[model samples]
Target: MAGSRKIELTEALALGSEWRHMCFAILYAPDPRMLFGRIPLRYAVLMEMRFDGRLGFPGGFVNSQKRTLEDGLNRELLTKLGEAASAFSVERTEYRNSHAEDTTHVVAHFYAKRLTLEQLEAVEAGAPKAKDHGLEVLGLVRVPLYTLRDGVGGLPAFLENSFIGAAREVLLEALRDLELVEPGSVLNFKRHSFRQPSLNS
Candidate 1:
């Protein structure tokens, strides 16, 4: 069940009360800015550089026994981000999909929200001052939403970094489904096997 994908939010929330729930979000905005007057920056997708040196979205496990999933996610946002987190509106309708880590009896729910460039910038500016700064979250990392002329930079190059848990797949699918990255680009990741090279070779 670890490999299961695309479960609807309703189906996921309806599961037997034995499963644990974790939530994360892809906070993005239309970045109509450019660098050096060329190569439009396109969009700003926010992720976190965790204290563990792995990349992930800004959220954590929620106790469904108390708060609803979205409330739990926003609660995490308030801690990982500062007062700027209040600007986020992640309703149940924005729910993307769920992933089953049946081995651990945990299911992760993903969400995506589009914000104004100003609001997105606020989240970045306030992050360093958040309660979890340098503890659980090292800092905010923006996903490169562009491909360079050489065709290997931007998203492709960014993909080389390590992602936490199923965050990598969560990112690729979010980009493809949101029409931010071409389907081919997501397919090219090919399950992200990091094969070690032999010293003799």
Candidate 2:
């Protein structure tokens, strides 16, 4: 289980205080639906299947003294995406959220970045040769953000997919913050998910 809330730090801890930590990159490209900005538009999120068979973004442990967060992100990308890392230009990376994981007791930091469609395609094309493929990573998947604009419901169904750690929650919060999906819809989806029986049920 993972904490449902964000990590709250009263005072900054020493650099080495954290025993376990991780970073994830949420990369997105403009959706095809954005044709001349005339149709409903949404960004497409890159997700992947972890070795544990759960879904999550790409990225890994941070070597704070050795590299910046973006550098760490790029390193992980290279590991999972191979030489495709050279194709993408990281527009900017924003802090997404933080979660204190229960299983490993690791603090996870998430960052969102925008990439050109061509770059994303390059990464996808190079995935088969990625060093971590089939070991640390099982395969790549995409979260369809275009459905988020649906009035009846779409975000919840997307969330229904099994996501590792606090990924689902992090995505929900991030999507809300990005204004890609309405908060009310997410709230409704939360309520809907809560009413359902757990998978173990």
lDDT string, candidate 2, 1-201, tens digits: 355346643211122455456778877777667634754546667889999878898888867557665677778889987898767634223766667655455667778877877888788889989999989988888775544345434455667677887888777766767666544655665566434347797
The residue-by-residue lDDT of candidate 1 on 52-111, one tens digit each, is 888999988898879899999999899989889997668888888888766677788889
Winning candidate number (lDDT): 1
lDDT of 1 at 97: 81
lDDT score, candidate 1, position 127: 94
Report per-prediction Cα RMSD to one decimal: 3.0, 4.0
Model 1 worst lDDT run, 10 consecutive residues:
190-199
> Which parts of model 1 have CA positions greater than 4 angstroms off?
1-6, 182-201
Candidate 1 versus the native: TM-score?
0.87
Off by over 4 Å in 2: 8-18, 34-41, 89-93, 146-154, 194-201
